[model samples]
Target: MAAGEVTLDPEIALFLREMRAEWAQHPPLESLGFPEQRAVCEAVRARWAEGGPRMARTIERVFDPGAGKLHVRVYLPDGAGDPAPALVYLHGGGFTLFSIDTHDRLMREYAAAGGFAVIGVDYPLSPEHKYPVALNRIEALMLWLRTHAAELGVDPARLAIGGDSAGANLSFATALRLRDRGEEGLVSAILSNYGYFSTTVSDEAEARFGGPGSIMDRAEAVSYYANYLTDIERERSDPLACPLLADLAALPPVLLVIPECDLLTEQSLVMDARLRAAGVAAEAIVYPGTTHSFLEAMSLAAVARQGIADGARFVAGCLSR
Candidate 1:
C-alpha cells in the first residue's frame, strides 16, 4: 500500500491531535536546549502515563555495577508468584529523550497482562553519555539480573527483553552482546515495538512520512542517530549501533510490533526478513492504520491495547517454556 494512501486509526489520530495541541503550548523544540526539550517532552508524555493498571508491588533500585548509576523500577502484578518471570523493558525517545517514568504505565500494563514482573531501566541518555555508555550499562543490568533475580523477585532463567524505538534497538543489541559472550540463553524472547534499527531513512519513507505534520520526520530521525553515535559515518554501519546490520543468527524468538505508518517501519520489515533468513524464529505484526509511538496511546486507542496484548502474549508464551 502507498504511504500517502495509508490511513491512521481514528483513535490514534485523535491521540496525536491531543499531543500536538499539548506540544503547541510550549516553545518550538529547536529553540530550546536538549535538557529543555526533554523536560517539555516528559511533561507532555506524563499525562498519557497516568490512569493505567496499578501494580501489586513496585520497587526502585540504584545499581552501580561499574558503568555509572543505573536506576531501575520493578513492577510486580497481582497473582505473580515469587520469582516471577520478568521482561526487562526499555523506553524509546531516540536514545536522547524520555525515561522510565515516561513509560511507567506501559510497563505496568505488561506486568498485569503477562502475569509477570517488569523491570524498567532508566539508562543514561546520549550526547552527554554517548554510545557504549548506555549499552554497557544495559548489558551490565542483564548480567546482574542473571545472579540477582531473586533480589528483584524475578526468574533468572525465564527472562525476556523488549522496548520501543531506541529501546528496541538496545534490547536487540544487548542480546547480540550476550550471544557474543556465549550467554544467549539469558534472553528467551525479544519484544520489539516499532524499533528504530537503522541510521538511514529511505527516500520513499522520507517522502511519505517525513513531511511536515508528521510525528517524526527524516531530519528528526537523522538528528537522533547523530546524537546517539560519536561518528555517524563509522558507527552507522556498526551492527551493534544498527541491529538491522547485525548477524541475527542464534537469537531467541523475536516478536516485532510494527506500526505500518511509521517512518521507521521499513527498518523493522527489513530486520524481520534478515532474522528469518538467518534461521531465527521471528514474527512481525504490522498494525494497520498506526503511526510511530502509537502504543503509548493505549489509554485511548484499541489498536495500542492490541499491540500491548500481543506483546504480552508473546512474552508469556516464551517465559512459560
Candidate 2:
C-alpha cells in the first residue's frame, strides 16, 4: 500500500483500508459458488446507487443491435463543440459489479480534462450476458460510432476506447476485433487499467499472495471467464476475448495503466511488452500508491486523476499521430 514516495488522498487511503478488511472476509470463493457470488454482487451494486452527482450530461443513447440496449452516457464538457475526439468509455466490474453510474466520476473527469466526448457504454453484465455478450455489444456500438460519426458529432478517425480492469480487457479486444473484421474505420488507440489479458494463471499464481488484483480474485476470474464463453467447456481463441492473449500485430497504439500494489500489475506489463515487441506503439505505466479501484475515486486520489489524464492524452495523441 506504500506506493512509491507519493501519499494517497485520505478518503482513498481509508477506502483501501476498508477494502483490505474484506480481502478474506468472504471465505474461499469456491465455497460461495456462482449463485452466492452473484448475490453479493447485487447487494454491492445496490449500495453503490446511493452516490454520484446530479449534473452529469447525457450525450448519446443507442438501442443495441443485440439483445439489450447500449445506453451510452455522453460526458461533454461545458465548452465542447464541433467534432471533438470521442472516447468510447467502459466501466470495470469484472463484467459483474459496476455500472455506468458507478464510474461516473472518472468519465466526467475525462470529458472535462481532455475536452473529449466520452460515450460511456453501459454494456451487459456477466453471469447473465457473459463472455462475448458485452464485447459484441461494444463492437456494434463502435460500428455505429464510425458509420454515424456526424450524428455523434465526432471524428471516427479520432476514436479511442478504454476501461478499467475487465472493461480494459474488453476495449483492447474490441480494437483488435475491429481490425480483424477489416473494418476501415477503427479506433486510433486504446487504454487498459489494471488489464487482465491471458486466461492462463499459473499454479504459483493461485498458491501464494494470490494472482491478479483482489478486485477480481483467481476463482472469480476463472468463473467469470467461463461464464462469458459461448460454448460448453470449449474455449475460443479469438483475441477479442483476451486482447493480451491475442496477436498484437496490426493493432493501433495502446496505453496500459498498472497499479503498483495491485496483483494484476504483471498482466498489464506483459501485454505492454507484447504490444511493443509487435511494433504496435504500446506504452505501460505503473501508478504507485493506489489500489485497484483508485480510478473510480479520482475525486479523492490525485494519482488516480493523473492516471486518467495520462490515458486521455495517450488516446488523443494516437488520433493526432
Which structure among the candidates has the greatest TM-score?
1
> 46 in model 2: Cα distance from truth in Å?
8.3
Per-candidate local distance difference test: 0.94, 0.70
lDDT of 1 by residue, 78-147 (tens): 9888989999999999999999989999999999999989999999998898898999999998998899
How does residue 292 of candidate 2 score in lDDT?
Answer: 69
Q: Which candidate comes out best when scored by lDDT?
A: 1
Give the per-residue Cα lDDT of candidate 1 at 62.
92
Model 2, stretches more than 4 Å misplaced?
1-12, 19-57, 60-62, 65-68, 203-215, 231-233
Error of 2 at 31 (Å): 9.5
What's the count of clashing pairs in each model shown?
0, 4
Listing every candidate in turn, what is its Cα RMSD in Å to the true structure after a full C-alpha superposition? Answer: 1.3, 4.1
Ten-residue stretch with the least lDDT total in model 1:
1-10
Off by over 4 Å in 1: 1-3
